[model samples]
Target: MPRLPAPLTLPPGHDAAGATGPDPAAARDRYRALRRRRRTETATAWAFVAPSVAVIVGLAILPVIWSLLLSFQADDLVTPSRWVGLDNYRALRQDPHFSQAVGNTLKYTAMYVPLSMLLGLGLALALNRKVRFVGLYRTLFFVPFVISATAQGVLFSFILDPQFGAANSVLHHLGISQQGFLTDPGQALLVLVAISLWSGTGFCMVVYLAALQDVPASLIEAARLDGAGRRHLLRHVVLPTLAPVNVFLLVWQLIESLQVFDLVYVTTKGGPLGSTTVVVYFVWQQAFQNFTAGYGAASAYVLAVALFVIAAGARALRRRDAGSPEGAAR
Candidate 1:
């Protein structure tokens, strides 16, 4: 090779070093400009968020606070309140109706949550295959979920009427005695559960379907290649992949079932000997029907506590799973 050219000299902004030095004043000015821009952005963000925060504090947060305080007092909507701390809670502890309502809510949640999830999962698994008219099928399945709970209750009530309803007519035609579907205290709760399942399973199905789509095809194929059967694949791969969604659906359905009111309101109205009187309906009865606002508030707080506990438990479960050995292996 020929002789190499000499290295270029640093012209300025250097202190015995080849590296070019930035101007101090210009750097400070740029820093100040960035800070100003950030401040402006933060202020604009807060401005946009202020309205929503105000609405939430006024409507949701304030009402929750008010209810907590109200739970300790004696008040009708028309009357001035008297502070009778803990009395409302104590009364609720001894109330047979309240006890029954709690039991009913638990019973409903126990049955509804698992059954609906199973039904939805089964439907999702079925619909995930390569089938014609899949979109139409999905739309049809989800239609009931979009219907209001009040509408579902009304529709079911008319269909299950003991006198001249379609259900009883079918029973009659099948040579069976006409059953008191909604009117029978023994059957009313069960009927409501069935109706609720009809309307809510679609929602569960949609969520599960979405989750199933996110399942890794590579993992599934690997499982199959490793001689895993369908059952094994579902147990070891599919269900595990949908774990978060499962937890979500479980908690959501648990809360929904516990707070069920619209169906009870429109259908049996907590009638047929209060067999279908869930906790929410019971609270409404106490607050609106009996004008025992404080007592109702106390009952509602009890429910709120239960929901908080459940949410906490779910979060703990998620954390534990994330820290688990199996999770690390995955």
Candidate 2:
């Protein structure tokens, strides 16, 4: 073999200097250049997003902070606001209407969330099969969701009217007495719950359908080959795979149910005896109709805190589930 050339040696600060340092001035200059580039990139990014950031701060964040502050002050829109720390919250504890609204909201959420989930999941599972006209079925199911909430509320108001309405007309033919749905205090909230389910189930069904479609068929087949029944496959393979989606739907439905107002406003208007006075409706009544903006703000803050807690708890549970062995397996 030809003798290898002697290993090249370079002076300190030269290009090929291995064990020696570079020129301090050049290194400093390169470091400064990198810092300037990073600063410029950051400034450019912020400049690009400045409009959106400003809009959000002005419309969303500022309003939220203002509402929180307003909760401690008494304002009636026309008059100057006066500070009354915790008075609004304290009054809420003693206000029968407020208590009733809270109870009604909870009742609605409790009934609505589970029913919507079950009905939606059932529809999704059925439609997920290779049944005939699946596209048509999906479109029909989601049609209600596509309709605006105002339109649905108006339509249902007509359908559920005690007299001269399709629902009661069918009941009459069946020999059942015409029921006072929106008029009867006892039944108004339940009727609203039903209307909500009808209008909202389609969205939930679509979400579930998407999640179900994403479930791996191979895992399902493997489970079946290992003697797993349909229930076992669903419980073990499908549900675990769709855990994140389920949690998301649960939280979303809960929040939506809690903030229900449009249908109640259109149909019951808090009703014959405040039967359907959910918290949001109550807030509206106080802020606009009654001119007690501070009290309304306090009520809104309470609801906001409650929703935040619920969402945070659900997110934490989801995180824990994702880190578990079963979720990892999926």
Candidate 3:
């Protein structure tokens, strides 16, 4: 202990404090490097999106603008050179057939959407379990959705034929008269609506099934412990969980029903006194068949606006519902 300890000394290059402060130059360099990296990432993202944006602008936006221009012009497909202002829209309002088409479209949507949703929900509820050959059942149920609408129309046309058709034959065997499925003005649209429901319900069922899978097993078990039956569980749990899916299906079905044309054209050709003629079919008739392209375009715009209003109303309802306490809890 003879020698006193030399005072501890730090190196000149090092700070006396350990890890207590940032080096400003190093931080500035890091900041600049991070900014450069972010810029590079943003540029890469835009590069990936550019092609899709270009395609959408070219195909969807350009065609919509062109159609708008055409709607204001007195132009056939052959000569789209003349301008006519709002005459086409005015003419659309005055036409009795247009009014009928509008009525038929509304009727179709009203009949089709609810029935499809109900059928789908029912089927999903019945089949949302492990069962024998469930995969096969699901496949069979979904097959119709993949079939082309035109093919479906032709198949139904033959099946609904008055003479030598299976459907009528079955009715005859059942002591029922052979009814005009597609030929009667009163029944044609209804038959089409039924067929649409049959085909579309499968898609909705699949959606519901997917949603049902996401339902909490714990909640279901609790419900069962509380002696909740199928009806009670569906009412209190499943339905609430499925509200969003139902809304989507309802809006989509309504839009699709309004735009229905292929089946009517392929099966009935809008015959039986134009009973099957929805607004879209009428638009097709005016544009392609009668050379009233401008008028047809105008009618299309009107239909688009109607769809917009319906969709907007639905969205508003959804928003209001979502803002409520019940929706928030779900």
The TM-score, computed over Cα atoms with residue i paired to residue i, of candidate 2 is: 0.87
RMSD over all Cα atoms, model 1? 4.3
**What is the Å distance of residue 15 in model 2 from its true position?**
8.6
lDDT of each: 0.92, 0.91, 0.89
lDDT by residue for model 3 (1-330), tens? 699989977654457774345568878999999999999999999999999999999999998999999899887788646999999999988999999999888899889888988988888887898989888887788788888789999999999998977999999999999899899998999999988977888998898889999999999999999999988998998788888888888888888888888888999888789898899999899999999889999999999999999899999989988999988988
**Best candidate per lDDT, number?**
1
TM-score of 1: 0.87
Root-mean-square deviation of every model: 4.3, 3.9, 3.7
Minimum summed lDDT over a 10-residue window in model 1 is located at 10-19
lDDT of 2 by residue, 174-234 (tens): 9999899999999998988898888789999999999999988787888889999988888
Which prediction has more favorable TM-score, 1 or 3?
1
* lDDT comparison, 2 vs 3, better candidate: 2
RMSD of 3: 3.7
Off by over 4 Å in 1: 1-43
Q: Candidate 3 — what's its lDDT? A: 0.89
- Give candidate 3's error at residue 168 in angstroms: 2.3
- TM-score for candidate 3, please give it: 0.84
